[model samples]
Target: MARKTFNAQAHSLCLLVLVIVDAAAARGDVVSANASGEAMAQREFDYFALALQWPGSYCQRTRHCCSSSACCQSNPLAEFTIHGLWPDYNDGHYPSCCRDSDFSIKKISSLMPELQKHWPSLSCGSPSLCHGGKGIRQIFLYLNRNLLRSQFPDEKKHGTCSYPVILDEYSYFSVALDLYFKYNITKILSNEGILASNAETYSVEDIISAIKKAVGALPLLECRRGNGLNGDASSAISWLIVNEPFAPFNVL
Candidate 1:
């Protein structure tokens, strides 16, 4: 899955969060058809902020070679694809936007099966057309959440400096491993709803709503608990991260 960035041509906020910032200006690249148009959505900003802060571990930060040795360089698609698969993987590294670090794998792992159960085809569709490939759901969720937000900021207002919670707590490796295994768990738990050998049954909105509901149900202690069966709050963060993990473009 290719991590998506905000397209100022199509959206409002100019920030590009989680995915690689380098791709924001690159041309001739094959982005999702909906990406350009959707990049302007409202959720883009939230997703973008979270995504931009991803630690070097999952983002392959060292790979980014820039003319100036200032900011970390990266590929949006690579980052998005990798992060979207599992959102709760926070490693104690303050993503650039903020200065903090902590890896919370157990917190993120608990939500994987529910995600898979809700949207089976999430990472299984065509990479270009929003189909399979492992990280597609992660990328798409980020894009979907922020795309519309970016385009219509006036319509839907989100706080500019909302503190990033989940990514700040887990590790990518732990999260991914959980997702891989939990997918099977979802099938076992929601067997009637989940047909064998079929893709996830829920729509993107359904998955998103479930995530929100799950997170809203968490108590302060529960939220802090994080990792390993932490329940809805963990799941909510996972869902948000999966949908929008990139920051708004920071170009002129």
Candidate 2:
């Protein structure tokens, strides 16, 4: 299956909570994408796979490198930035924004506090887009128009279709955040003495072992090709899938 990062062009919060961040089984570059076309939208989807992205990889690719992300800029110990929680099909292809709901500032006003705290936009821009008067959502939209091109697309595209069973927009995002908190990759790695360093690349087995040791299962570690700045051909996890051993997390 393809593990996508909740990419951020500039302002929108990039949150890719693709799958489980728990007892995971590490899948390497050999991941099969041979899922049939019918699998793309044949059913309502099995469950969500909340994937996360490495801030360094995300920033470098988007030209917004480290300095912009709070985790990258200040806290060397911060965890991975959220990519998104997608509605996955039984196969590789997943469902996308299927509803007619347009992006409205009012829709997510209630989630602002948590959104701002955990899912803050990593792109650099003036914070005064809100003008004055309870216009935080307005500012958010401004960023969506100018800076955040991908966030809303990912949300509406996937979020719209993830209703009824997943509840609504609020459940979609809140669950992803909850999953993120449940699986702390950085802390998991550190516990096993596997510190993250751009200079060193850990093997898939090693990464999997560390995660399993911490959480008692395997996790999917998705990576991106190197961008020549590092000279290394493969970068560490740009995307991750934490697995659940007991049973797949399906409210269905």
Highest-scoring model, TM-score: 2
User: Could you tally the backbone clashes for each prediction?
Assistant: 69, 30
RMSD of 2: 10.6
TM-score of each: 0.18, 0.60
**lDDT tens digits by residue: candidate 2, 6-43:** 11112212232334422332222111111221112224
TM-score of 1: 0.18
Ten-residue stretch with the least lDDT total in model 1: 7-16
lDDT of each: 0.23, 0.47
Model 1, span 1-252: residue lDDT tens:
422221111111111122112122212212121322232211111122222111222222234433321123332321111122211112321111111123233453554454322222212112232222122234333322322112111101111112232222223323333433432222332333422111232322343333234332111100111122112222112222222223112221
Residue 221 of model 2, lDDT score? 56
